[model samples]
Target: MGERIKLPNDPHSPEFWVAVRQAQGIVGPVATDTISALIDAYEAAWPGLPRKLADSTKEKYRQSLRVVREAWGNLQAESLRPSHVQALIETLGATKPGTANNVLDALRAMCRWACGPREFLSRDPTQGVTHFEQGEGHKPWTPEQLAFASDNLTGMLRRAYVLGRYTGQRISDLVRLGWTDIDDGGFNLRQKKTGARPWCPIFSELEVEMSTWEKRPGPFLLQETGKPFTTNGLWKKLDKVREDHPQLAGAVWHGLRANAVIRLRQDGYTSMQISDAVGMSIPMVERYSRYADRKAGGQAILLSMKERKQDKTVKR
Candidate 1:
């Protein structure tokens, strides 16, 4: 050969070699030994996955696998060790324990796939690795934070916030909300994540806010262009709004779900009632109602003390 083809500067880029192979008219699957190739093969056989992965879940996997591919794409799949997986998790856990756990989950799923009928890898690297401990999940918005958001956000963003707070729905479900869903004094929806059919009654505050809005033919929340928002589209818009308003930074959309549960609990709704209203399980309802429970307990104790003191004075 007069001259050898030069490899790309980034030696670990699986895409570069793939392009080269295509250019040379080589039409076949990549060598299965490398991690990158094995990952590709595993994804190609996605339907064979143990459980059906949702679109949102697949998006998370894609994000985690990008890091994995960058770090060990060119290495042999069999070379991945538990130590390597553990080290990666630890490094990622320093800043984002939740993300680290998600990454570990992705790795475990991929490795398990490879070790099964696929046989892309001889062993699982993530076998002994574990996820980082996570905290109490999303932080519910304080009343002050909620007031600030309500006063500041306008138009579609305001509508989005009102829907999230009052309806207690996820951003995914929120994007799909429309006038059609409104019936019998509530919004009836089959939750996308859990498939629970919840009928969230129109709260007085929500009704007052909605009464002023111009009725639309599409979804309740729309872009400035009058188009209904995709889930990612709404998230990006809300993120931009949050960035501009630092006071609203602590208030996340998912946290609104917790806020809704707490509000119902504070209003004296039972756990079963709250669960029915929010389309959440009883355990989740109890978890979110903890703050409300403490407040209610304190109020009850104080009321009992006042009654006892009044009786003592009467007897005196």
Candidate 2:
């Protein structure tokens, strides 16, 4: 054996013993809590008590987290590698590319937070993994589709669709609204994902439509008895509507909110104006206004063509 090298510290001290043990690589395993365990706790603590997230956004992340937890919950944080994450993307992406990308984003975000100051993770396992390519976000409801729902749907469905189209609020929040939620001025409510309280102004047209339903019993528009509609309940109603009308294919509730943004874009509203009207972040408003931006680009091209033709005629 080589000569003893520990001459600096007191051999009898616990500190010295810890150092000696560490020197021999005899440290215990990193925190034994599994990824699943951490995820379980995270879900429980979600939306932050005081800070709060919008209910719909919570559901979206909840679904993604549930999927990731099902796949990697038992695996140790350090055990997860880029290849493992890639495999998850491939497996999940087969059925729904968009949802697979959502899951990937959720995992990456959660793992990044875990590795932050919390030290729940030694490092982010999702490193170097790219999210699956996704198509453009939710398809906005057309004005014609809105008109159809307004005309066709008799009781609750008609109200839900029209309100969604005009207010541009999330279904989760919108369905819970009652007479008290709206007054002569406008509709007022807190966002489900973000906790911001947005007061959407009610136009005369929207007001006229809402007046027809305000006399009903509960504050909730789409209700069973007197209670607000659950997220799934609202979806089922929309699904039934789709079954009846095929023209409404591929449209979802979130898209209903986008309809207002799209309309604002067509009216040539800036990103800031749309954000103000829709109670969304400026960035989100910009994203929703992409179609409007595209239209504006075309208009610019037309203007340039006209200017060139006019210049040529004047020179001649």
Candidate 3:
């Protein structure tokens, strides 16, 4: 019965109920068109909209949609209003702003699809809902913190840190990075979030670290079991180590991406150069490297005058 229905086999889901009814050869209305039913239909609509989205994105949507279904599963899909969506967002946004935004995004996607060719709903309920304002995002690891982790973190955990620092790739792309992706130049990446293919050159520091490590058969980074880690698995493993060490409390994996930008900028790499190397947009590269750029500008201003140079020369 589970095999017949392509959706998850959870008996609590409306899809499961509908599947059960059909399997039992029962007559009458199988199920009403509710939010849960809409979700089931959307997910099952293969060669359809969900197929166009990345697996990670679809998973996120499923998570958010599950929350929506639980809240309003019994309500008719067409009857849903923007006010209801706004209230839900406000309720969740009160505590988990990020999660509330994710729910809003998921509903917007579903509602757009529903209004389009799918026609699941006549109107979009999440039409006017606004996303919650988020903070500046992940904090970059300082050079001192990076050095501490380098000296202390052991095995694959250390390798994960180094890999993130050098590659500036997302955890999703990092996990998928294999030994086969390496070449004479550097690492080859087909980013999961964006389809952009970026080439990461091997920095001297990264090469020195890589030389000390064993050449694994699969991914350059691996679990203790010698298997490639899932994105969340790697995060949890690294985060546990971060929590144990007080210096690394502020360091997150994604922050390494910003650290990479800062490092590049400090080394005289242009924003365009960093963007191309890291698979980030120029605007994002500029955003991440702003401090480095400002520092460079300040130094240039201080050194631009002959008097400052003469004073340094006199002191020397």
Local distance difference test scores for all models: 0.82, 0.74, 0.82
Q: What is candidate 2's lDDT per residue for 220-308, written digit by digit as tens?
A: 46466766777788899889879889978888999987888887778777877777767888877777777778878999999999999
Question: In what order do the candidates fall by lDDT, top score first?
Answer: 1, 3, 2
Of candidate 1, the 10-residue stretch with the lowest lDDT total is 7-16
Overall local distance difference test of candidate 2: 0.74
The order by descending TM-score is 3, 2, 1
lDDT of 1 at 188: 92
Q: Pick the TM-score winner.
A: 3
The whole-model C-alpha lDDT of candidate 1 against the native structure comes to: 0.82
RMSD of each: 7.0, 10.7, 5.5
The digit string of per-residue lDDT tens for model 1 on 93-135 reads 9999988998888888888877866566788888878777557
Worst 10 residues of 3 by lDDT: 1-10
TM-score of each: 0.67, 0.72, 0.74
- Superposed by TM-score, candidate 3 places the C-alpha of residue 197 at a distance from the truth, in angstroms, of 3.4
